[model samples]
Target chain A: MPREDQGPLLEFKAVNTYYGDLHVLKDVNYTIGRGEIVSLLGGNACGKSTTMKTIMGVVRPTRGSVTFDGQPIEKLATSERVKRGIAPVLEARRLFPRMTVYENLEMGAYTQKRGAQFDEDLERVYSLFPRVKERRNQVSGTLSGGEQQMVAIGRALMARPRLICMDEPSMGLSPLYVEQVFDIIQEINRQGTTIFMVEQNAAMALSIAHRAYVLQTGKVVLSGTAAELRENPAIKEAYLGELQVPAAA
Target chain B: MTAVDVYLQQAINGVSLGAMYALLALGFTLVYGILELINFAHFNVFMVGSFVGLGMLELLGVMPNDPALTGLTLVGVLLLTFAVTMVFSGALGVLIERVALRPLRNIRGPASMITTIGVSYVLFNIVLLGFGADAKNFPSPLPQVQFAIGGAVLRLREILIWVISIGLMGGLTYFVQFTKMGKAMRATAQDPDAARMMGVEVDRVIITAFFLGSALAGAGGLMFGLYYNITSYVIGFQAGLRAFTAAVLGGIGNVPGAMLGGIIIGLVEAFGSYWISAAWADVIIFSILVLVLVFKPAGLLGRIAPNKS
Candidate 1:
């Protein structure tokens, strides 16, 4: 559990979500501090994705409050939530397939007032994903998986979000691409953007996460600093499985 | 009739008819583009516009034989019908959305289609019951001025059809290409979920689309009444079906395609009816559709990639 004095940027107070009477997320609680990289680590069917969806307002919680920046966003519409600087890079890179990469980014800045600020935001997105700038006119659907993922992240960043909730950025990507994505995530966090990520790759996630929560069966089982969670025996046995050999040896 | 003169006359007539078809087809395409569901009740909205025009004429006490008041009365009736039909039909679109569509949100595609067809029949019967079965004659607003162009005759009605259709099309094109709201509509049509995430009120944008589309259909209906000088309960059904066919032929969800398809269909029908046989006009059009489908199913200007969910 995080200390009470840490002052969370986002706090979910016992969130309970249901999909037509089937309990999906049961009494889930967690917090991420401002400018922190926090990962919700879990295996499949463990409600990690559900937690992200709930925060993004894609799925509403039946019983709980999701407070972001001291404002409760539980009842706000998904679009309205987006306008308030809360953006989510959904799993599977949910891009507007027919639209070009640049158009997709412009869409992200849809909520922003139409002016010079919007143009500056587009430039920032292009700068962050230089590959996207190279292929600005390419249709998002035709792009490679890694490139598409970059477009998704770039699109979200166009909103100039206070917090970005990413759902499995490493999924379906090659190892090199995975590492690149992680580096970008770290770079973004270093630039003072708080990130809440849901990842099955616990080892990599824990390495960068300032704080982390291990979720099991719709509930949080453990919470601690990155180093503490890395050393935890339960995570090692279930997620890490085996250690790599030293290069010198 | 001399071959060249007959051809020229037919071409002029086809152009006028094409303009009206394009106007109506735009409504069909715009609605279908935004919402995947086909609004069968759109036809009834067109029929309602005719009724509104008739009501306006009656209120103004314009008679078919009264030449003095006919011109002024026509303008008044057209404006009154346009305003009333737009608002009323737009409300009908909203009502259909809320009552018919909202409840069936979870229902799959085929079922929604059948439900819309059922709604269309219900609207047809209601209009039939309200208005008598007889076809009512509408008084013409303009003096039937005819001009000879290259040995072919052209009427004032034909000229009005071209001017109105082109003017409206240009206005709509400008609106869609330049306006902020139009951009929002296009974005929503492309991706509803992404549009919502962009802070676009998807439902409101859809409502605006419906209002604009239905209003256009209403305008077409008033023009149809003026040109044909008759209105009937079942008139919208045939016209609606043709407009829908035009929409499909041009590419179901493409706005510009609808216009192109409508004009093509009009020209085909006119040429077929004049040269071959009136009985085979529809058959020829449908055959053309089959050929288009087999060769290029996406229609003339359709996007190559399928829309992402």
Candidate 2:
């Protein structure tokens, strides 16, 4: 939990994004406080990924403003936004597959100058994921799904970002990896980097998130603390049912 | 000359000829790797480089049939000409990308490609009007020196071609392999959207690709001039087709593939001309292109990428 004296670390005020003429995110509002783990929860095609894109400046919102740490960042370029300390762990663990694991981690700090600081960050990431260190010279594409996800998270950490935005971090992972990924996410948040994650896994997302927003068809239908949303029967019916389906079997 | 000597001489000629194609093919592959657009106008950039080199040489007081200067003076003039011509052609490439292709970036498909063909025509006419239709005598300052290796004659131009082209290729390889911008370029090629999320300046990378590719084309133009001692607007079309073929033969988007493809095309053309006739050389090269496309569409070094969209 962060002190209430300061403003939210990231704030999206009525942001609406479009792909061509098709509206993908409709007046979406979100607030993530400093050192907090905020999860954006939604089903497929519900604009969850678009929200992440908006944060990273991959997709610009036609209307509304996004502020980070008291600065308006809606008009900034993606690289400029990254220099302002925002980094993304893209969907499907979009690591540079052809590059070696070490190279991929090097790219994570693309916005920063290479020096002792880079070496320190690399050391830190290695400590967090020993497997990443062991596979440093191997090509990233050959890594298994779980390992790739670990590398992806390690790659984002290389940026030394103040806030890391992750999109569907658990997608395509085995159940065992899923729990491990969630544990890492929690551990990362505890280390003081704010996280804003988008997940289709409602049960898993709400389990570790401090606060969460539920989205459906480009709109935020509900927003509250994770504990409150977990007990909400409506959310359980809409999203948590995914976990329930397998459990019922 | 003995049969072995004849083959050795052709091999020498082929390698030198292939050096120019390798440079031009790199331009094509670099642009295609990033934009997936075949810059048909790139050949004309090479053409412009020839004229620009000629103009620079003239400005430096070197004229046709001048006493071929040797030693440091020749090297100095050559270096200056190469630098100026490359920068000129590189700027032209950036202009083409900025004015012609960048606007149509959002609206995908054949629009930008068709626009490149249009730009090619525009460049062709501009050069045609600027330097007449006749073949311009492009002079070289190098002393016409030749040495024999095992009964096969080799010239200074051939060695210089090999050295310079190999040097440029090696430099490009090092840059792409070790540099930060190079990593970003690779990342952009693999996945543009994902790269953007990483804070890569995607547009700047595209511009850099155009600049580097065009600059290489400029160098190729100068090499063609130095090798053949003549250049014209028609050369871009004739040689551009050959370079384009090299790019496709090597696997269109593969950098090293382009280099290998160019050399093979050069050797094939050399042998085809010697064994058959100069007129049939082009037919043989185009046939290789057709065969490669039909059998191994990915080229030798290219991998078949699954369609992302």
Which DockQ value does candidate 1 get? 0.56
For model 2, how does the per-residue alpha-carbon lDDT over A9-104 read when each residue is reduced to its tens digit? Answer: 999999999998899989889989999999998889989888988888878899999999888999999999888889899889888878899999
Span of ten consecutive residues with least summed lDDT in model 2 chain A:
A240-249
For candidate 1, list the clashing residue pairs, or say none: none
Model 2 chain B worst lDDT run, 10 consecutive residues: B300-309
- Give DockQ for candidates 1 onward, in order: 0.56, 0.67
The best candidate by DockQ is 2
Give candidate 2's TM-score.
0.96
Cand. 1 Cα-lDDT: 0.81
Per-residue error at B268 for model 2, in Å?
A: 0.7
Q: What share of the reference contacts survives in each candidate? A: 0.72, 0.65
Candidate 1 local lDDT, B63-151, one digit each (tens): 55456334665566656756776677667767777788768866876776677788778777887898878988876766778999777
Name the top TM-score candidate.
Answer: 2
